[model samples]
Target: MSTRTETDSMGAIEVPSKAYWGAQTQRSKENFAIGHQPMPLAVVHALAHIKKAAARVNANLGELPTDIAQLIEQAADEVIAGELDQHFPLTVWQTGSGTQTNMNVNEVIAGRANEISGQTRGGKSPVHPNDHVNRAQSSNDCFPTAMHIAVLQAVTLHLTPAIKTLRDGIDQQAKRYEKLVKTGRTHMMDATPVTFGQELSAFVAQLDYAQTAIDNSLPAVCELAQGGTAVGTGLNSSPGFAEAIAKELAQLTELPLRSAPNKFAALAGHEPLVTLSGAIKTLAVTLMKLANDLRLLGSGPRAGLAEVHLPANEPGSSIMPGKVNPTQCEALSMLACQVIGNDTTISIAASQGHLQLNVFKPVIVHNLLESIELLADGCVNFQKQCIAGMTANEQQMAAHLENGLMLVTALNRHIGYDNAAKIAKKAYEDNQTLRQAALDLGLVTDEQFSQWVRPEDMLQPE
Candidate 1:
């Protein structure tokens, strides 16, 4: 190895001497450097924006001189504009205290701000990172504030649309299959006749509820923890800092951002995050139900329910000569499981908060953001490959309707249900078909039964 003095000849490094963080960042980078699961990128960007926005609000106040205030605001702006993104490299599995992430943000903002003011990176010469940039904040408040922003934006831009796409696909399929009559199965056996459209419409209705829950929960997330500096008391902040910061953030984010109703409550723990995780859990449950339907409808082409045909993305099996599977449904189901697991982790972490601060924020943010990302991705794929491409198998569905012994509802109109039930029981006992039993019983006139017993017409009460 020529070992060209290997002195970082490009000089492409910015060293941080005094970390803006208190202590947690150092220990975390050393402790959980195992997995590749990095912190959410949206979170990193949002944190920088929160810092810059806070600086702008502070600078606007009459307390600070105009020159210094403007300089601080400019530095914070540059970091939000993507200057400090690279320096925030760390895994999500750091200590639950979130000290590492807090420090990572502080160091990056301070270093970038110093560079903007023509000072050396990480220099405290005139503007110390903690003294000036992190003036009246702590990881306790800042992390939760950033987490709120990241989550709100994600639901508005990503999750909402993904869910709508899935819902619309189901609604569309429902319309397409509205006239298609199929035997409805319960307990793994045919029970009644229902239109394919009716089945899909139920799914659409469920997704609607899930979406509504998500939308309603997001506004609560807008309540931020800016002024709740250390332990949620606005202990070290200026008198008007919280309101001013809220105004600045609202202007920057175009959201109705506001201060937490109680600083003490905000700093005590991350209950808002817990609520958000619960919302995600609801969405995951909807996905699980939808996946269950997909698997059931696509159960088998020759030996199973096979009510609807799934879009064949790839060969479904290694051994079966001609097997195509509901892979997209499987993927969505798998992602739903992951989200469920992450929700459990979040719930556990949320409950683990000590007296003053919930040290579990880093893990909470990591798992929550991960769930959001996976759910968004899964919804998009399920819409395109599964719901959008699904086709109604009319012939098979009709055959199932004809084979089902549950079409006795049609005979109920002509003969009373008791007689129809007796006839049906006799048919099942004697291995005779319902149609044959009805003909043998002569309980239903041919003319009366023609309109009554038709599968398509039997979906509605006759």
Candidate 2:
């Protein structure tokens, strides 16, 4: 490939001729060959938004030239539109402060701006990367600000809607099964009779609670640390720069973003992200339980619970001739596990902010974004592929309900607990029905037994 020399404070390096990144970006790309996981494009696009907002703010403050600022704004627009995606090639494992990725964005925007002004890409002549593109900011402030923007937008635009879609789908299924009674289980054993609708409603409630928790954590995430340049002192930044830039960003992204009240706390720690991750983790736990319950209820067509039938999306085993599997449930459960694990990583990373900055920004944002995307995509798939097509096995549920010894629970108030226990034990040990057992035990007459032991009557309170 053709190459061109680009210069930074360190020195000059040979960058690909077609690449828009400068020397620092090239150095980072070459220096950190750690892993294949590139910095999230969401973060890169967020950085572009920051740069665009910063340019407009800087020009309004008369700190930057208008022509130069306009060029930078246009370049930033391209980046935000994903037109310059290939230019940001830094890995997440580079600098702890995400300085490299920040500079990568700066270099790309500068190069593209220069090109727009009929200048070459390598040198920062018409639009210097640091002075023009990144005027009132440091990587410390810019990266965290970008992290917050990316996470907030993703959760609101993607995850929230996906959760609601799945929740609504499950709710429709619940209504359809409202009158379909089935045997309820506790401790993996039969307990009593319950309507299938009531059981599924529990999952709906869990998702509702989880979505509320996630929504509550967002106001804190909306607080941006943009003006806390370097050590949160706002050293080179002009007065009102923080608030002005926040206004610009809010206008650009259509979010309720505002400058953080305490720039020190915003830069030095990541409490908001930790709180959000905890909420997401709670959601993961809820999804895990829901998926597991569905898997168990839909376990077997012949030998297992078979109380509900999951959509047969794929074959269960490679060699099995006629086995269908709960693949969507398994997939959703696995995604939940991954999100739960990501929460642990985010928590530990959030705690490691030593002095005036949390150096673990990249990893924290990477994991958080990954969890959000996984959950959003997983919910959509589970809803469309599994929950949408799911059907209740009423015949199997009714048979199980009739065979359950726990139905004897209904006889307690009439015959007393001791008598009820005696009838249940006799029915199990002697292989007799509850009615026959009650007759032989002489607990109640046939007419009374019929009145006292109805499964449908046991569904609600007496």
Best candidate according to lDDT: 2
Residue-level lDDT of model 2, residues 185-217, one tens digit each, is 999999999999999999999999999999999
Candidate 1 per-residue C-alpha lDDT over 1-462 given as tens digits, one digit per residue, 9 for 90 to 100: 111110122333333343332223444556678788888777777777777776666666654555555666676665567755556668877755554676677655655556567865554545555666676778788888888888888878888899888889889989988888888978877788888899899888888888887777777788898888888888778888988888788888787889888876666567777888888888899899889887888888888778788888899889998888888888888899999999899888888778877777777888888888899888888999888889988888888788788888667757888989987887788888787777788876666656677776767754
Off by over 4 Å in 2: none
Residue-level lDDT for 380 in candidate 1: 88
The alpha-carbon deviation from the true structure for residue 336 of candidate 2, after best TM-score superposition, in angstroms, is: 0.7
List all candidate RMSDs to the true structure: 4.4, 0.8
TM-score of each: 0.90, 0.99
Error of 2 at 179 (Å): 0.6
Taken over the whole model, the C-alpha lDDT of each candidate is: 0.75, 0.93
